[model samples]
Target: MNKHLLADRVKALTPSSTLAITAKAKELKAQGVDVIGLGAGEPDFNTPDHIIEAAYESMKAGETKYTPAAGTADLKKAVSQKFEKDQHIAYSPDEIFVGSGAKHVLYCLFQAILNEADEVIIPTPYWVSYPEQVKLAGGTPVYVEGKESNHYKITADQLRAAATEKTKAIIINSPSNPTGMIYSKEELSSLAEVCVENNILMVSDEIYEKLTYGEEKHISIASISEEFKKQTIIVNGVSKSHSMTGWRIGYAAGEKAIIKAMTNLASHSTSNPTTTAQFGALAAYTGTQQPVEEMRAAFEGRLNQVFDSLNAIQGFRCLKPQGAFYLFPNVKEAAVSCGFTTVDEFAADLLEKANVAVIPGSGFGSDDNIRLSYATDLKSFKEAIKRIAAYVNEHSSASD
Candidate 1:
């Protein structure tokens, strides 16, 4: 008999549906299908010229040697200053760890902290990777569902009910992935109180910190109190803010001990983020705010256009998002009325018939929704929505 080899954890893991959809969209586009993809998560903007120049200069200066496992001192200090300036949360250089991206830093933290059977409280409609990463780290993911009535924000009572003696941490993604719902200061304080009382570590993903719309300021849970800061890990980066996703530089600020452990894990796994990327990220932190604000304004304008267009369609319910570039509209009513059994079917049909690609809500732990990224050019955005609206209207009278 042939020998079979595979780790049980690896065998049990599910493929990322979001990435799968993105890949399929790309495949269709490559085949000259005129695919309008609303599934991409990253910004469509290019990295700023100044930041790109910094990376070019670094290469010329031969700053190619490997740096510290965590990051170079300059980058770490830049990250420290960023927290102080933006979030009003102070952090020492020792409390910072730089990784390839916020995603990598989060994975390393989980690998260091989670033990077998440890429970992690995650709010639903979360980023697709949260639960899978927890499972890969040998932790159990306990989901707390957020409803539309509350603007998709989970309540303190919900967090309390999901907690147990075995619970180790809670993942909080304000300006959340699928819904783009941000927790207000009051809401964050209430949830922080629960975590403080229960001794739960809070992993706050603030990657989209600068992309908020209107008066909805992004509040860091760590900024609420020193006690909360001690238990909270603030994960952020320049990917969304500076449109530097391809640069692959992200960092986390937290208690010195936890940061140290994450750095040690990095030492063994990936030694450090690319030297050039770190230099570019440092420039991103120190550069002027004009580019960042420009991108934010564009996203805000596009967001309004998409939100209004989606709300006009029959059987579609949408809430105006306060942050992030994506609009997640609930299409359950449309699914039921148009003979589609699930959001997945709705998305697939739209792609086939309307030639528009979107991510199904089930990928983001939502069953009745679909996420549409308006990160493309305005012309493409308008055309895609027009096609989508027409298709839904034409199919609206069908019975499931």
Candidate 2:
């Protein structure tokens, strides 16, 4: 194959730094290194047994054939009911479409909506995939910084400043990845108004809705009003809620026109999401809420413990995230105190010397922070934190 013949779009694409660093960590672990990896974003729990059993039952009943391009009607209806049951947002089956995972659902959405020269406003410290997906769909990503002082969430005015005639959409993630901060109902309403005023679509990624800690509750912006309902599209999945990441099931619910367009695109591209996975997802939406609660409690427990540990390190500043299972700490001062040139360099040194793996903040569009996942066991997480604290202390320039 001639390398030159590859499409320019494919050539220009940026690979996911999180996955790359994760792979590197795995390689080191395979060689028997005592590497403590805190890079994964998924829950470590297994799929709830009931959901697994339902998929088995479906397969035994010969439900393994290709489902509708959007999803099986039964699964679609379950997703719709789940929305109303959990978020109080109502939608019909025609407005719902399940795909391979939330990521795939988002990809198809961008492909369906974006055209050349269009722009999508994305908040900084974003999930790594948002910009790349927008670019892949031939749209530009306009970044609006969610200041650290503001708990890493941009205000309505900042969003307004970023919108342009070519702007087509905005991506909002609650219990956001990297930061784990959730937007309050008031904040969502203000931003929703901006989207309405601009006639821009709100792409809400709520995959981490079930993992929030403390008094934090996840709210859907679309639930604010009928007008917001029209302006918003929700992308979510059973992956996080059911600890079924490997099962590969996610869905989108929104305006019928967009759902139909995504369904047609999916029909041609994927034919259908994996047949068995859709059945598994159906069980997840309709299954018992007990397992989800158990996992959430476990995550909540880990978050508080890890949050305290993170802030204890000298020069390390971290917010107690309201949701999600990761910690994003501003380690710029810590990195500088240790005489490292950049956070990326400090991260590399930590992985090699301390045998601890964390993602550099640069990949998430912030160069002064590092992301640590508390998805692993409490024991291992403490050990990782201990090693990090020791390394930074031992190498402090002030000490020397």
Q: Of the candidates shown, which would achieve the greatest TM-score relative to the real structure?
A: 2
State each model's CA lDDT, in order: 0.90, 0.92
TM-score of 2: 0.98
Which numbered prediction scores highest in lDDT against the true structure? 2
Evaluate residue 307 in candidate 2 and report its C-alpha lDDT on the 0 to 100 scale: 76
- The residue pairs found clashing in candidate 2 are none
Residue pairs whose backbone atoms clash in candidate 1? none
Candidate 2 lDDT score relative to the true structure: 0.92
Candidate 2 on 19-129: residue-level lDDT in tens? 988999999999999999999888899999988898899899998888899999999999888888888889999999899899999999999999999999999889999
Model 1 C-alpha RMSD vs. true structure (Å) is 1.4
